[model samples]
Target: MHLSDHDLRQFDDAYLQTLTSAQARALLGKALADLKAARERLGQNPSNSSRPPSTRLPWEGVGGQETPAGEPEVPAVSGDVAAVADTPGAAAEPEETADPRPRRQGSRRPLSGAPPGRRPGTPGHSRTQHLPVDAEQSHRPTCCAGCGQALTDAHASRAHNARYEIELIQPGVGATGLLLHQTKHTYYECACDCGHWTQAQPGRAQAEVEWTVALTEWHLAGPLLVAFICALSQRMRLSRARVREFLSDWLGLELSTATINQCLHEAGRAVAPVVEAELYAAVRNVELRYADETSWKEHGRLRWLWVFTCATATLFVVGKRSVEVVRQVLGETFNGWLMSDGFWAYRDLDQRLRCLAHLIRKAQALEDGLEPAAQRFGIEILTVIATVMAAVYDARGAPPPAGALRARHAPMLNALLNECLRQRDAPHEKTRALARELLNDWDTFWVVLDHPELPLTNNEAERALRHWVIARRIGMGTRTAQGTRAFAHLASVIETCRKRAVSPWPYLAEVVRQRRQGLQAPPLPSPAS
Candidate 1:
């Protein structure tokens, strides 16, 4: 049998896979390393391998002079002055001369009233100038009040002086403003054997004030970094090295690829504790909280980012997408309404408020190409439930009477529930059977109708997770588990601030500053505030 190149390659791949597990892993690791190295080299010298060689012209001649392509000729210069002199009315024309001395171009003569010995356009030569004021002339006040006598050094005894004042007048928008400051010093003089001398002890010098390392860290890790990484990795789709180059060029900061990775790791670690506390608080809220999960990666390993958001706070957790993680984060005994999609992991949670939006979508699919009666019935039930929810939501501060609303929608909801049960028992296909399994959680699905405050869907959590999803597409994934944790923490804090209508950058700056100063955490302003 003859094999093509593709077939041969496939056969080779199969043969390689048949090796011992350890050997296979080693081979795969080596291959991955090689690919990574190749990518790095390509990023460093993108155009080097593709450039063409340059060509040069050859010179050869009888007199060792360069020859023209087709023919060689003598160079000529015209002495046009004699031609013009022999012409009629030539003397009437203006005389011209080429001095050939290097003439200065673009030089401007100094303007009148220019500063002494200063050239035109020279630095500090033009525009309004500021004259220095002597300290004695500027600071001396023009007033005398001590015993209504002219004040002087002799009249004002330094021994009995209580304080000295210094007033600074600084330029403002239109005029100068006075800045009154005080300097208190005690006068002391000791009588020496030969002569008298005076000495004044100085106060302790205050330390220079500047941003702390922690504050610098917060600014570096906040939205600016998040936006940069997202734009480079996701939006621009650049490799890590390219991203680093762009960041360095634009931010005026030097960061190695490894250091960038490490900063992300450290940022994750810094926010983990706060994230855990916020997550607990969000889960413990009695009012309904929306929950959702989306795929993420850490060091190229498949992971998930779980979002749990209430009206007041939003929390993110990064881990394996499983029921265990959900239970671990939200706790097994979580009794308050848990609003989520039809994911089976959430089945174990009691009082689950299954997202009706998802259910309506499924029902719409089921009704397509169905018998008229079944389609009408499904549509009617969906409409009734939607109308009830709409009325509840529209009532705002005054929610519709739950008992009355339930009474009106109960019959249609019950009929829909019965239809779901019937379909589950006798599904048309394997896919339909899975749909039936989701329908089996019907009781939990309609629980949202009973409580107006409980959201009909996990849209809040999903919206909160959008930033992470975008970051994932950009940065690919976190390089480590700790980095993932830090991302979750920062994302949670940022989203929480957003939900509360507070600016995240300034808030994060303040939090880092106050925390370092051993100050209490300021209460986050309300959404209205």
Candidate 2:
């Protein structure tokens, strides 16, 4: 919306001093009228206002802003601004937008092509011979299908022709702890006492890799290499029993579960330093970052698993929840924007975006069960927020060209803040807590208004922690400090690789390969790099 010519003349910083009393009164009155009209038209729907339709409150009805179709109007109080509900007969609706994407219709159902019964075709991978079986056994029509006649041992009396059949046996999921003896070759000795040496090797290992509760060394081939893959959970959640099961089923090697645990710890020790350096480096140079911590267990003692994520890399650490841990991850000086919940450790950032989504949740919670005044206050604050959000959304979420949003909406935001600040000292504990959060982080929350493009949420960091959360649920956390280190490095690599669209297994293989060879672990995955 552009200012009127009269208002523009009055709006000039130095020119405002020359305006006469009558002219100033006329201009101010017109501006108030325009502001009132704008306010009335607001909340017509989610398209024009930041207020999600879900928070419309007990005060809205069809095509309504704050009152039901026939209910008597109430003044909508958002701070000092009182918006009389749009009258029932007064038509108010957001301007319709033309979306190019096709609108979906009805509930989604599964495609109706294939029947539910078993398919007529063979199952997947039934024909492909991806892995070579170690040993092969063949029979020449061992028994006749029609007569059940036992075939002679191979060529009985040199039969002219014989029918032959072949089949391949491969390992699959089976009884846990089942051990399959690796196929071997029996070397034959010369009867003549001649000196001859021959041997068979399935593969070669550069170093000794074993299944241990703590990783002593990372082996580069066979189960040793894949053990890193399992420890890092590239293929599955890392549980010693599960790792043992996987090794037996996939590599056909029976391994003690304790060794699986050791491999896991070794993996952490192997790459922790390499991962730590890269993570520290990545966060400092990143454009935008998110930091969060979730409960973690180290040998059953509670520890914090922290994550610092950006668009390209994710760094995770397991340590105590203190200023030191934050410094350990992000250091004393970071140039990029930090988005986080109002955790004190992150408050040191010079540039930060406080998560508005958390405040919104608190508001929603207030509305859910708080006293009438608090509920109304929460809704009012939400309304002001929705106003700014709706305006930004209308702009296709482009960051406003400098000072535009602040100039237009900062007053409204301040008004909302004033109410929260007042409530911060209210008698009720929940009410006081909610209000205090807003008051303490007032400046941080409003920063989002200045850069509408910046997310008003720290969901990125929250989301990064989910990988560890699920793993924690399954494995119940790590047992040793090294185990925690391994978990953190593996998680960091896994998340970073995912962000870069680089699979973790191959990168992990390189890390395991290099670390075992007394070389530095591979750097974090970066597709562009």
Candidate 3:
């Protein structure tokens, strides 16, 4: 039935007029087939295929992405948008610097548009623990400034500055029955023999990129406390107010929501540099990576959260869902096999494995419809695919070489391709689309046959996003740029640890401690043997 270019050119009206009745019927059939194809192309819509909803016309009915086979179609759940911003209980909005001016209460307050962070100098909570200082340490200059001379404790003139740090007592430290301990650090100015006064100061660390919440050692909360807050908010998916309530009710710590919120941001900012530089570097070296994206909201506006995962590490990014994001993650020349659904962004990658489950779902939709031809096509394709998949499964530990597999499965594969070619202009729009999709990325569809080690679906990446998708539904989304960064970096660390069979809490606490001391946080802990 194949026609060459010259044969196709002979179908003009001038040549058709001279045909006899039998020839004329053959020509008429071809003309009707072309008309049907043109009409089917014009009928494309989002519900029937991978086309975006925006492409749907005004007359079309509303629908979302086609749900996969055997999985119930979960409608978008709407609820009150929980605020996870730097400002506790505030709605999602742009990050704003906290105003130092005093804000009045109740009726005197403005109706709307209060800037983010703590609202204009409202009184904040103070520490409830009044424990006595367990130890005190003094810092003083040991050398003269003007002259090269050694100094002793007698050279200390006076204690100029002092601060207290409340740290959690380690589990096996003492039998004092105290959960916390305090340390008083006193800084003194020592007078040298040359009459030069050198002052010792407490060390301070700041974020390389400024955020709404500042990262410094002056805060009342210790590194472990900050890490605990992150575990509650980021890992446990608790809102700011919920975290405050948990601490107050359970730990007898009367922490303001503002402080809890700041701790979350500070922890995120602390580990962000290490997460971005080291963790992402690890992701780039994996051989088989899976990726998926889901909707996210930033400041009440639409955004996307992308996840890239492998066996040992996972990375999450909150940004635009574009090809550039894929390139940014996998680099311009990624040689590893990618397992993903048929997103346009992933199409350009030379080595990819299309998720067969997605194709099977589309074929199932065709089978469930009223068209006889479509249903038959669907049943045939599904049987063909299932047989190949089962064969792959049976070969579990010992996969046949590509040549052997091709020899065994070539007849079935050829038959499926022939059917797809015949049904390319199917009367059912979905049938036509399914056929065309298979034909376009035919190699990706059968890549698993050639490389048995590659996955058959993108379930790993999708599973990684499942928990956060619920968080997105519960908390709406992050409110500011800092919140977005915190959510992504912290989630990456948490999931990566879970994948590697390690606990992230202790490592995260250590990261906060080192970063606050103006030192680089340590690399993410590796999986235990």
Candidate 4:
């Protein structure tokens, strides 16, 4: 039932007194039905409706999740609650339950007493091809461990422990094919005058990385090999299996997926400190920053990927899409101007710019809605936003005094606010929602009107996430917390390097090399002037 603004507002005792008993009852019934419909719409999610994936709640796809198409949803009930609900007029207490339907083949419990990991008799893979050494180096003890006596190669023992390391070499000038270089390192024991023997061992990083592999010089694959794996996995967006195939086909390297994955993770862990100590710190000090988040997955569980970007640096984080995450990235004391969408997590920030593009899109949706009044309201708001943006564009060359644009557009804005206030409880849910949104954060919409330098959209942060978003689709996101951490830090470094107009691969290789040697990575290059 379509009602005029006056009719909607005058639903008081005086207005009802004019209606007959039957008419009042019918109106009440219709109001209840509308209320039910509104509540149902509020419950709509990505799986069942046209809502975006961002709108999905944390608990939606977890325990007692929504059932598949054609199957009726059976609200989960515990054994005790089920018994109580069986009685007349007893309401059942909803509880979390495992989804009864199998998600894929063999998703159900395996035969009792079956062991975990690879099944018995499964074909195993390992390194079989021997790499010929291209260079040989000896590492000999310089001093005696038993005393402070100095020793040299002349006192070295005849017996020595030798190991080989394989690395990727850049194609030389005019070279076309991928090349692999091998090096043999021989460690010799030294005999001191005191009869003490000492031998040098490979170095290990003092700083520990939380991953399956340790960052040490003793690895079979060298630093450049690790960096190349990262470029294939993170930059080139190749899956582990695909990277294996590429290496085998092009370079005749028979590395396993496990090795490639380990290299990628090690590289990611190596650069984690760089992002935290340098890039994230740089993002905090910037005058303006953009922030955004998208859905991600870790071990088949839903997660969020957050990005904070400025002109000079970009940082990425993967975790819960909560206010804490925003605080973790930007911190509570961040006074820089934050340009982002209307996510509630950012509402507390003192200096923030609401993405006008996001609001315009919402208004556009309202314009396409079934409600006629909502359509008109959408058109009017769009006009007001366009006018404000135009005023900012005009003052770009020579900005006017503070509050000039706001004062100029006061009449138009006040009219829009008045209309929104009137329609805050409109019959159409979308109209009511937009009205409430506008009324809640009214100041953010007009902030750019005063300071023409501020951006109207959060496109910078969104663009920074584009590459990873594509990678997420291709690789289906990371598989573990360590994997997620690696992906985020590596992505941050790569994007930041791009923003500074520097090649990330070589820098990443150097970082891996230094980190493995238990040394600090080289600093990221400064932005080009």
Specify the highest-lDDT model's number: 4
Instruction: Write model 4 residue lDDT over 1-529, tens digit each, in one string.
Output: 3455666797888888999999988898777656655544544544334354554554467321456678665664665778887877667546747775444454654344555677778987657899788999888877889997888757848546888889888888988766799999887888888888887888777755366667888878888888788888888899999999998888888888888878888888789779889987888988999998899999889999999999999999899989999888887788879998778999989888888877776777666554568789989989999998999998898889888878999999999999999999997777798899898889988898888988988879877887888898778899889889888988899899999998898899889889888888889988777
TM-score of 1: 0.51
- The 0-to-1 C-alpha lDDT of every candidate, in the order given, reads 0.55, 0.62, 0.79, 0.82
Q: Report the lDDT tens digits of candidate 2 across residue range 1-529.
A: 3366664665775766788999778767766656644543453343233344444655666444455467787654663233334345335646757655444355235345556666778564322323333553232333434344444443232222221112112245773532233222222211111222222112122343332332222221233344444543533675677766766577555456654555555666666766767767887787788888878988779998888988888898888888898777777776878898877887777888887777776665555442577678768867876886687675554555787877888679778878877887885455788788777777788776666777777889877877567778677888777567667776777778778887776666566656654666666766645
What lDDT is obtained when candidate 1 is compared to the true structure?
Answer: 0.55
Compute the lDDT of residue 381 as modeled in candidate 3.
83
Q: Which residue runs does candidate 1 get wrong by more than 4 Å?
A: 1-243, 332-335, 368-381, 390-402, 434-439, 510-528
Clashing pairs in 4: none
TM-score of each: 0.51, 0.59, 0.74, 0.79
Instruction: List per-candidate RMSD values in Å.
Output: 24.1, 21.9, 11.7, 10.6
Clashes of each: 3, 10, 0, 0
lDDT score of residue 279 within candidate 3: 73
Model 3: weakest 10-residue lDDT segment is 76-85
Residue-by-residue lDDT tens digits, candidate 3, 54-134:
455443457433455776654333233322333475664668667655556644444455655666668865566576888
Q: Which candidate achieves the best TM-score against the true structure?
A: 4
TM-score of candidate 4 relative to the true fold: 0.79
